[model samples]
Target: MSRFFQRLTFVLAATIFAALGLGFALGEFGMFGVHAGGEQDGAYRQMHVYAEVLKRIQSDYVTDPNINTVTTGALHGLLESLDADSSYLTPTEYKIYKNRPTTGVAQIGLIVSKRYGYATIVSVIPGSPADREHLADGDVIESIGDTSTRELSLAVIRLMLEGKTGSTLSLSVVRPRKPDPDKITLTRTVVSPPALSEQQYENSSILYLKPGELTAARVDELAAKIKAAGKTRKILLDLRDVSEGDADQGIRVANFFINQGTLAVLEGQKFPRQTFSADPSKFLTSAPVAVLVNRGTYGAAELAADAVEDAKRGDVVGERTFGEGSVQKTIEMPDGSALLLTVAKYEGPDGKKIQDEAVAPTVIVSQNTDDDIDADNPQPKQGDEILNKALALLKAKNS
Candidate 1:
């Protein structure tokens, strides 16, 4: 009788172990033998159920649905469930998004935002299409052709505003300064969005380098330009709107200014914190520098700013930066669809987290009401106020 009881107990234990193993396999690898419990398990179950539903519809539906469309929709729905920012990008959109910083395309040369249900221009590019149209800052973009910008997403508004070179967009604008607040139409033209546009201040030897995208080549080009100018007493590096880029490029760029110290550190789940530093010999360590940043400066841009500030290469000026210090790697699937997976979190040279908390400038300048404008002709009253402030700081440092 005792031997019989032992045999029964052994059988029960073996069954439980097999069930647990099966559950783990299904949960982790989606083998679909057994199921687990908890949120992750539920997510897996839902995915499995969705697959089954798709298979059923393909086999027994009244009419066959487009498989590609169904698959795309499913993926989109999955991403949307994760978060608003998480979305699938097609091959074309993915290429455009990834190469913007490197190739210098997709820049409309203006800072815009959605305000009070209207697409209002926050600031105009100094020499951009809107600036050339005499679009002063403080214009309210009422519509684009027949389409009202009311409640339009910033992405849609941007698509409306941007097009291939020579493509024109008609905008209805409401300018406060004009005698009559009427709709003004404007044409979109290809403006050279320079990686670095330099201007010498009238009275001081301060050189303002408004870097749109801080590439390694651009940084080198900027340094050469400043060197050729030969009289720049101070440098102002404008990093507003600059986002992520190649880490190798970022490292090379940082080497141009920093004289041998830790540039930034990247830490992830799989690997320990990797420290990147500048080579001592390659430092562009002469001039007193001031960095200009705003909420749009993120990722590689923020990393560069942090490196400069931490190494004492320059003082950071302007408004707080957009805290996006997480590092994402582009994972390409067998299909054209790709996933930008956030794999790691990084810190500036000063060991500060730039994820949720934006990097505060040494001199904090608030965005004034006069800084906003219309889309077609976004000429803010005090346009490029942040840039102007950076220039002022550079001049002061030189003086």
Candidate 2:
């Protein structure tokens, strides 16, 4: 038993030391905040604890455990503990992630993130298969196919959810007020994001624009609409369920209305602070504006909404946004595995990390949670409550 323990300890120490040496050689230790002396000693102590736990699991288990599998699980849990965006991919998974097919890949249109160690639906794209199936936000996906999501990394879960068009993926989901997971099979399809929804409320005085996703094209559509609406119209930008897009697009979107002042800031331990200021050329209108957000609003949309709110360029209405705004750096390991580590995060004008502190609406309007609906009837029981509130605020400003 002593011999076995000594061998395990030696192997663990050797592996950790090699990793530390590689990181130092590559100057990556600074990104991970691993320094000399006290911090390094603490890290070694924690590693000893991990080894002890593994030793117990190997020796005193009901049956002989696979140490490799156990170690992989521990690595997964460790990265997830840091943040939802950070993940550890095995060698096989890293290959898949690196060579992931970009073109002709279809999806169920569910934007997912890890929450409580399970894959949680952040938003369902409008008119997509998931949307048509009534898969709403906050839905906990217990498993994908036969594999439990709890055992899968966020990257893996996302990869499993995509495939050829017309292909189907099975899911076990636990929704609000549901005790057990319901089995669901969603047909994957090439989800075409609906065009920027534009409407005129209160006799054309308020130009309401809902860009379902903050794609570059969608922002371009928004710019055109804002310019066409002219200075007389009050802008009502609804960023609900707008999770997909490049972070720069969000910055560009905020620059549309904000002629001056800071829009958002990006910084990290090693990443230099970059303050995104509104370009005078990009500023479109000085019209009264109110941005509407909900729990479904995430990533880039959160940045845009928070920037507007922080700068006081517009009133952010509705529920607090789904907190997510971080840039990840993919660090490849010597063993061919990889780590998707969040190196930097976006912050609003108020200097709050969007990932840590999501955008809070200046005027809070909660979504109706009591409404129960099935696949046949997907719409909520209540009307557009958030829309009504934003419209009221905009009209009051007009008055």
Model 1, runs deviating above 4 Å: 1-31, 35-74, 77-86, 90-191, 200-205, 226-232, 241-253, 270-273, 325-337, 351-355, 368-399
lDDT for every model?
0.59, 0.82
What ranges in model 2 sit over 4 Å off?
1-36, 369-382
Model 1 RMSD in Å is: 10.9
Instruction: TM-score each candidate.
Output: 0.59, 0.90
Local lDDT at 174 for model 1: 81
On a 0 to 1 TM-score scale, where does candidate 2 land against the true structure?
0.90
The alpha-carbon deviation from the true structure for residue 96 of candidate 1, after best TM-score superposition, in angstroms, is 10
Q: Candidate 2, 197: how far from true, in Å?
A: 0.9
